[model samples]
Target: MRVALMITCFNDALFPDTGKAVLTVLRRLGVEVDFPAAQACCAQPMVNTGYLDEAVPVVRNFVRAFEGYDAIVAPSGSCAGSIRHQHGLVARRSGDAGLATAVARLAPRSYEFSEFLVDVLGVEDVGASFPHRVTFHPTCHSLRMLGVGDRPQRLLRKVHGLQLVDLPAAGECCGFGGTFAVKNADTSIAMGADKARRVLETGAEVLVAGDNSCLMHIGGILSRQRAGVRVMHLAEVLASHEGAA
Candidate 1:
């Protein structure tokens, strides 16, 4: 199937490698993937920050940019959740029937990385091999919004020689709620500090999460504290094989 890679704004800027890893993994799976040059943010930021009205143009651009793909796949659960859950709210809040209809048509076609791999592609192993003790952090959108529970772990477990470890306080929010970080800096830092501590306690060499946004937030604190742990996106780990890392 032809799939459009909806690279989120942050990933486009700070974590381009994650986007590349996602593309490489999908292409390795023999799936047709396209990167639409016109694509931008899914308007998740504006909608999350109580600026639903401001998100209309972004939502429109998203729909227009990805008009042709049979399915939309993003490396981020937050972006996928925005398209699947928040787009309609933004449209209706603005009283735009046409925009809502457009979102309705497009939303169902979008899938988070894990969801597309486990639910649509129907496979646990993407034929990747990464031999390291790694732990997973279930980002809020992936866990609470998308309910993509254990799908990521299932895929990780199938990787040859990969050792998956349980993260302490798994399933807790890392407090990188996009704009929520700025609006509530202290609270965000406190939550991130706690998450970083958990990552350290796990004794895993790598901390993996589906969303890089959360990793960025949690990783910054961990790095600042010199935690000595590496933060990686799931796609990156999933793309690594015997000699690929």
Candidate 2:
């Protein structure tokens, strides 16, 4: 199976480690994944911000870069959801039947990391061993957009020595909705503060979520409060092995 990693622009820039961790976990699981250099943003930002006309080139580039891969795996549900649910809209808006056809062919092949692991790979335990108290926050896109219910939790539960605590209001948005945070700073901070409070209530040493964008927002709040809590990508936690500190 030809599998490609669609490292979103957010991770490619701000959280490169998250992309690396995704490679680590997938490679450890015996999945030989490829990183197509031509890949770029999934055009989610433009689509979500009501700039579908402007997102045409990006969506076009996405399909071209990832074309022919049996599967395109993304660590972020936000990007994956965009590809699956939004790319088609952008293609149609461009009035390019060829682009529409391309989007139709490639979008369904995209898979969020957790969905790929639990659904496609059909493995719960990837032989990871992280001895830490971790709480997982289900990102809005992962939970609602992709319907990735309990898949992430199921994988976390199998990590040896890892204690997966239930995050209060796990389904609530962390207010890191890409441009939503920028356009609505006050509302975003308020929601992030609420999420930080919930993370602290778990008393977990680390906060884990599939999307680092959400983590960055909540982590910023925790950092300001000196919460001493670490934020890690779900891939990073899954990539952890015994005695590798």
Candidate 3:
């Protein structure tokens, strides 16, 4: 199967390690993944920020870059959800039937990392070993947009020496809704504090979430409080092995 990695722009700029970790985990699974140099932002920022027209070229670039891949795997549920749910809207708004058709064809083929692992690859354990007490925060897009319920948790359960703790109100949004954090700074910080409190309540060494955007927001709060808690992307945790620096 031809699989491509749609490393979203946020990851590319801020959390390049997450993208590398995704490659690590997929390669370890014997999945020969392709990284299309032509790939760019999934246009979620424009669409979510009320700039659908500006998003057309980005969406166009997205479908073109990942057109022929049998599956496009994105490490982010936010970007994957944008591709699956929002791309069609942008296409239709452009009044381009061809674009709409292209989006419909490619969107369904796009899968979030956990969805690809648990649903497509059908493997819970990817031979990962992380001896850490970790608590997972289900990002909003992953939980609500993609309906990736328990799939991430199921995979976490199988990691060797990993203790998966239940985060209080795991479904609540961390207020890192992309631009939402920037536009509504006060409310965003309040919500992030609440989420950070929950993470601390778990008393876990690390806070894990599929989307690094959310992790960054909460991690900032944790760092300011000197919480001494590390934030890691889910892919980073999964890519971890028994012995490697």
lDDT of every predicted structure (CA atoms)? 0.90, 0.93, 0.94
- lDDT string, candidate 3, 1-245, tens digits: 99999999889999999999999999999999999999999999999989999999999999889999999999999999999999999999999999999999999999999999999999999989999999999999888899999999999999999999999999999988888888999999999999999999999999999998989999999999999999999999999985534
Off by over 4 Å in 3: 243-245
lDDT of 1: 0.90
Model 2 residue 177 distance off true place after TM-score fit, in angstroms: 1.0
Candidate 1 worst ten-residue window by lDDT: 236-245
How far is 222's C-alpha from truth in model 1 (Å)?
Answer: 1.5
Compute each candidate's TM-score over C-alphas.
0.96, 0.98, 0.98
For model 1, how does the per-residue alpha-carbon lDDT over 1-245 read when each residue is reduced to its tens digit?
77989989989999999999988888898897889999988988888778888898988899899986889999999999999999999888878799888888889999999899889889888989888889999998988888999999999999888899999889789988988899899999999999999888889989999999999999999899988899999999999876544
Top candidate, metric lDDT:
3
lDDT by residue for model 2 over 62-126, one digit each (tens)? 88899999999999999999999999888988999999999999988999999999989999998
Q: How many residue pairs clash in model 2?
A: 0
Q: How many residue pairs clash in each candidate at the backbone level? A: 0, 0, 0
Error of 1 at 21 (Å): 0.6
Task: Give Cα distance to truth, residue 69, candidate 3, Å.
Answer: 0.4
Q: Return whichever of 2 and 3 wins on lDDT.
A: 3
